[model samples]
Target chain A: MIELDVTKSHVLHQWKADSPLIACRFSPTGDHCVSTSQDNRLQRWNIADGQKVVLEGHESWVHALTFNKTGDQLISGGCEGRLIWWSILEAQPKAIRSVEAHAGWIRGVEISPDGGMLVSVGNDQVIRLWKTDTGEKLHEWPAHERHIYSAAFHPDGQHLLTGDLLGKICVWKLSDRTLVRTLDAATLYSPNKGQNAEFGGVRSLAISPNGNEVYAAGTHKGSNPFGAVHEPLLLRFNWADGALTKSHVCDGIPGGLLYRAAALNDATLTAVSGGSSGGILLFFNATQEKEFHRAGLPSLARDMDIHPAKGLVATAHFDQHLRISALFA
Target chain B: MSNRARYACGSMDHALSRRRFLGASGLLGASGILGGVASLPSKVAGAIPKNDYRVVVFNMHGGLSQLESWDPKPSTNTGGPFRAIATSVPGIHISELLPKTAKQMHHLCLLRGVNTAEDDHGKGAYMMLTGRRQTPAAEYPQVGSVAAKMLHDDQTGLPGHIIITPGGGGGRGNEAAYLGPKFNSIHLGGDKPPQNSNKPDAIAQEAEERRHLLRRKINEQYLSQRRSAITDAYTHSYEQALKLMERREVFDVSKEPQAAQDKYGNSELGRQCLVARRLLENGVSFVQITHSNYDTHNDNFNFHIEQVGEFDLAYATFIEDLAERGMLEKTLVVVLSEFGRTPNINLYYGRDHWSKAWSVAMAGAKIVPGAAFGQTNKEGTEVVDGQVDHGDIFHTILRGVGVDSSQSLIVDGRELPIADPAAEPIWKVLV
Candidate 1:
């Protein structure tokens, strides 16, 4: 794995799209990048030549995407509650098949370590598992009472963690599909009474490479959610006992939400946050309570993912651009 | 200004007659319409007619997003995540956030091209409610006040105008302008009756009666010596207050059947809507219900999910109830807001204020049911057809309630048009 030195990070390239981008991911092989836009189209970018190919199928915003272990197949879920599988690495990647996955917005989708199973969660408050290649339903269970926002698989491939709008993180043993434990990232949720609203849920989740820890990111202290008055919060949890280990926050960045997070290693993590002011990429040491390094973006970012081979980060932004940045000099 | 005759008429139906039927009533005088006590023989009070024309305004406080309510551009770059579901009107569709309201669309008209051109909360609210641009030089009367004056039933004892707010302190609002204090709106907090509306138990019935008799005697002596609009307004308020106290139960939603309260839901807006329906049924000429905090600068989709969800159940139930009671044809229902949220979703996952292109809804009275007038672009960024503004809406509202929008009121010897003269009613959507 490439060593990450966030302080040396710099923008590598900026690719423009027709509409604001919501989420992006780097292919496992690190040669291809994919992004979803507000225009309801997904685009795959060839890293070396920058050639773009549209992967069109979703009838609504595609908010979540992931790749198979072999990097030959891609899966995505959208606001319309449809899931699609794409033929990645092809000259003109196309949707292989599509299926009605959830009754509401599919907030998250993840490929299990072995690439045989896929886990998805959504506004329907149901966690569904499917066979990656066949697009067939494997198992389904009522996960939470509120909308589920994110999901992650333990590196060990035995447990799955799902977070919800109420800031609850449920751990399920993949074998029986039964909840093994419930963890709290309560700081990531808030009830904004002034607007008669409940907001600030667990927006993104990431498990450490060693499977010893997990991270959840969202907004906190949302006093006036309608006015965009809040701050970003990232919680670290001990995977073994489900204890809240650390709370990482950026005091200077108010009215912001940590929309996406990724564990670079067992001791370090990266998160992208955005608000009315703008967006920022933050680097945190798992043991610390504050970000160690922060970099500002040209506009608000909706999602981020790191390249597996080079540890380069790709950020999807509201300015209709996907920014690629290297985490080392 | 005071040289003008106090009894000058306004509407074309009473044009140039130079006599105000309301002023001629003299049951308690102008002030008695405010809330204070005044002496009048109980036999003089006329029963309100069931068929009296009325107007109901749903003031959506803070900007409501057209993209999430009346107009949904699902799957578009600016549409967010909601789908546009089919309404009861067959081809008509609205944001799924208002599914319940959609079921009642056959009885409503959607004004899809509204461009008031003002975005500030205070200014937008002023324009939407007053039908005129806000200027330091002049203040226009609000729509409720105008409706009250135009539809005032001299025979009826209830206040002509009433506003139900979520957490308002019940009282009178100075929205009447030159119409005189009598047309000002009386506020009610949620479904509760006006504050201090009941006679205190601390006072004996005999003593209270004796005190009222003495006060009337003194007022009679003073009126004999000096009689003017000011004194009449003050004294008249008392009689109106007495009437309100006598029928205070009309504002109490608790008296409604348990099923009704449940149908309206248990949200704050639900309760306000129930009270609004009660007042309208009791012959209040104009009623306004305010649902608040739609100013979503962050978490727009989530906030709308909660706010609009609350609105759908209550508002839909209210419209359905009015129709079932056969009162809809004589009552105008308007759902409006200061402005609409932007089509562009900001970084905070919210939409800011947008007034260039939006939508409003109207139903009942003389409106064309199951009709959708005007049009917005595919992305809802601009109005593409049948554009109208606040002035037009004001005129349409009056015309819907059988009031002549072209008429002018003789106030203080000056001719004040009931609505803006520069604009006319949205005739296409009117019956």
Candidate 2:
């Protein structure tokens, strides 16, 4: 099990990413990882060996990346809104199929638990589902009034959750593509009073291992036009009831947002957020809605992936630094 | 005093000699105010030959986000969601939010290293406008005022300096401060005969003419006896106003062909750009248009898409339209703002005020188009080279129009260079 020593959490290793990492995901086995970056490239790394192979194809920032059920292939999307499927089994991963998927930046992608469908969401305010193996577009829907930041498949494999710029989250049944429910994560939208201007969104979504709870993370602040606040936030919700169970706000560091959130085997959450300022990492016990550990990262981390077996975390920072931090020795 | 003064009005054109210009300046006749007038040269008026060099300034009222417009970091943490696209200029790329402007890159020379240290809207605007820090002792005149003072063609029968939709106060730069109101921009647009210029449509033109003749006769008689500077200024203003009334059609863009109007788009900025072109065509020396709400501390990306998108179409169309008319050589178009947003993308997904590294675009005045003169660090956190400030910008724009940027004007007994004494024009961008 990973140790919960926040103070002792030090960077394990670091490398220059050449471009900021846009999104990253750890393989199911937690030994390997895949990441996309602003440089319009995809990369996969063997966490233990620290060996990486660059996969270049996307013409812009690679905004979304995910692994398939059997871990044979990786799916990714980016600024070009193109969905690319990569054969990850190879020493040099290859893009097997490329499909022009969205009209705007693809913000999130998730594969179904059964490995049958892949759900991708983007700034085009769309939620689309495709046949994972065939790269066939099965269903595409305008899911939100604003940019949809993240999408995820429910552990049951029959449901999906989508979060948007306006803090609206939608639950839909994948079987019939019916709208199951609409929930307000309004706390994420930091708005300035009397001004139509707002800065944050529901940028991240993670489901607890038990699948009973969902956590959404983003920026939270009061009335200010400049978006000058450095407050990152996490909100826990009862997935079954669509009720917000707890609002876990970060007081860890000056990082402005919780851009990415992940669920751990220990039933806790690891969150990261950063931009021009440095990144802040926080560990929260979702059920308790409380933070047990926190650490200030060395660079402005844009994305992160966790290797559960190794108790390791890898981050992509704005400084082009790809960092690895170990939770336990 | 200087050969440049003769360029101010045709009174010094080769047809009229220096001695004749002086003789004309000393006397006031119907022809003097009508076709042959030039501002009287003082002992201090130095030899600065003026040609018909016109300039138009688009003051983006709010601090525009540099990343989304000019220096897009695209895909970086600070770049937000916008993409950067290639422009006509071989290697130049700007935010995809400005597609039309991207196509017109060859006409735009970007100053990507503007470091105006002030960030507050009001103070920053003052710095950009006056090219100097705002001092409590006396307000510095703005670029428009200086242009008006140096280049106003008295024979144009219009205000030399003009501002359209100038928002009040704060770097919504008001009229000439220390330079006196004559050199101030005549506020126009929105509703016509702007404020006092309205000679009540209630009166018949002939009747108004009779009343004007009577007033002029009385003013001439009083001035003949009194000989006060204020009276002379008022009489000259009265003459100019009458001349403007006769040439009222100059401000009317409705007469422009529909094809031309459609080319500029149907938006307010479109109409203003079209009107600005006509004004420049009619010999207005300087025109300023302010596009507001660039202050994107919130929803920086979306707002920039809307606002900058609007600007791209109108500005591109305007540049192309002007170039096609062969006006580019004689006119300079400047796109600028107080400062730029920070390289940091704050929690709200908006960029805060960053005076450290920003950008401005200039064309005409023989500026090398498609040229990006400075470099910003990859993350756009700072300028890596060729950093310049507002004073240099002021110097560059004036230099484009043949104005002697090094010449000092006696402002409140202080010799203020036409451009700030601290700045020198960036020669690399100049032709």
Candidate 3:
């Protein structure tokens, strides 16, 4: 395995899309990748030859996308609240199963580590669990007062954590479907009274590979919520006690939002931020309060993901492009 | 004809009793009472007109997205996340975010091809409100001020031009320009009454009366030496202030029935709507309620969901109430913004300002109900037919309320067209 090196990272390949890309992910085999965009169709790109295939199903922008552990099937959630299961490996990539999952925009969909269950959260403030293969709902409940933005399952599979616009993290004990505890990441939320608006939220969440800590990323210090004038922030919490461990901040990026983040390893975390000024990729030590490495992108990025095995980073950008960068020279 | 009493009585059951006017002496300044006695218009004795037309303008401050409220382009790349829903008018649909407003579409007329060609916030607002582009050569009056000057009966106690803003401090807005402070908007910022509305305890009613009498004599002496429109406007503003105090109860939304308040909701926009209803019901000729912060450069979709959600409830309720009260026939209601948000969703999922093609909606008075006067392409990027501009909208608004937009107001012996003379009303959408 190649160790990730933030200092030596550089763009390796870039492919243009039909519209601004919302999210992207590498396949488990690391041979191909898929991306969701502002349009209804999803694009699958083969890493080797730059081959692209269109996976069509969603009626609106597909915001949430995830591949099952085996990479045979992919589930996508859209603004129209429809969830679709697609046969990604097939040449045509047909949508195998579709369900009306939520009442509003679906913000996130994550497959549990065991690959049997999928967790979805949406603007309706509800959390739902689904059978990955069948597209059948198992259990669902109103988990937050505000819109839930992201969700993550603990490595042990006993617990699930969800984050919302108010910067609240709820830990649900999966056995009884009960909330065990909540982690406070309030800095990620902003209630702008003058504008009569509430901006910011825990936009992205990730758990360490070893399950020792969890990271939440979003925006804070929003002086003008309507203008989207704010700063990017990343937070870490100790998994055992659920105590806030560190708050990582990037200075001087006014329109910044830590839109997506992923734990690269047990000790390192990477985040991509999009803003009025531009987009930035930042790397931080899990326990440290400062980001040690940073790189500016050509334009604003909406999402980012790590390679399944190789030291490569994939980012979906507003420039209507999907970028792949090698983390080591 | 009972002088201006028909207009003054409005829809209120309560009469403007002479005793009540005399008893409300301390609430106004001694000078205001004196000015009312000196400069009261001679036309106060004229017969009240049968059609006491009025206007209510909803300035959706910042830029409201045309796609989100009035003309949604669903399934298109620029349509954002919202879907289009059917409205009461056949073949008419609006964004799903405004479901309540959609139900009232039969009473509204849509102008989907408004191209103001100005995108800056201040400049855009100027064109929409004054019906003319911003130029250093001349300053024009806002529609509210023009409406007040044209439709208002001088004997009415309430100020003709009134504006309500959230968290706005009560005062006068300097929007009248050459129309003078007399026709300027008396701003009721927040839900509170006009600033310094209540009388101080130190000033006794009887003493205030004596002071008013003495000041009136001095004012007569001073006016005899120097009499001009500027002086008249100064004296008239004082009289307007006195009248405003006499009818200060009209500014209080708390006086509205609990059921009415509940129907309008309890949000700031809700309270402002209630106040607007009260002002209109009490015979104010022109009322402008500003619902703001729509300048969503970032997080446009989420912010609009919240902002337009609030507007949907309050606006629809206000329209329904006006119709129920039979005031809709006499009130020209318009919903306008400085500009519309761009169809292009930016990196922050927000929209920038776009003026090439957007929409504005108006209803009541002479406006043809359930009419869509213009058309945009499938993607809503540009207007394909029946294009109009700020000047056309301004003329249409005046024509709706029976004010001749083509006529010119003689200001200081100079002819100034009420609206832009180069542009005419959208006759296709008017009765």
Instruction: List candidate 1 segments past 4 Å from native.
Output: A156-158, A172-181, B1-51, B154-157, B198-228
Q: Rate the local accuracy (lDDT) of all candidates.
A: 0.83, 0.74, 0.84
| TM-score computed on alpha carbons, candidate 1 | 0.88
**DockQ order of candidates, top first:** 1, 3, 2
Tens digits of lDDT, candidate 1, A1-329: 67768898888888898988989998898898899998888989887767888888887888999999899988999988999989988988888988998987899999998989999899899999999989889999998999999999998999999999889999999999888999998888887543456788899999989888889999998766677778899998888899988888788887888989998767779999888658799999965789989999888898999874687889999998988989888
- Summed backbone clashes in each candidate are 13, 6, 1
How would you encode candidate 3's per-residue C-alpha lDDT over B303-405 as one tens digit per residue? 8888998999999998999999999899999999988989988778888889999999999999998888898898888999999999999999999999878
TM-score on alpha carbons, each prediction: 0.88, 0.70, 0.90
How many residue-pair clashes does candidate 3 contain?
1
All candidates: DockQ: 0.35, 0.11, 0.35
- Kindly list the per-residue Cα lDDT of model 2 for residues B34-85, writing each as its tens digit: 2221222211247546578888999876677889888889766567667889
Clashing residue pairs in candidate 3 (N, C-alpha, C atoms within 3 angstroms)? B168-B189
TM-score, candidate number 2 = 0.70
Per-candidate TM-score, chain A: 0.98, 0.92, 0.98
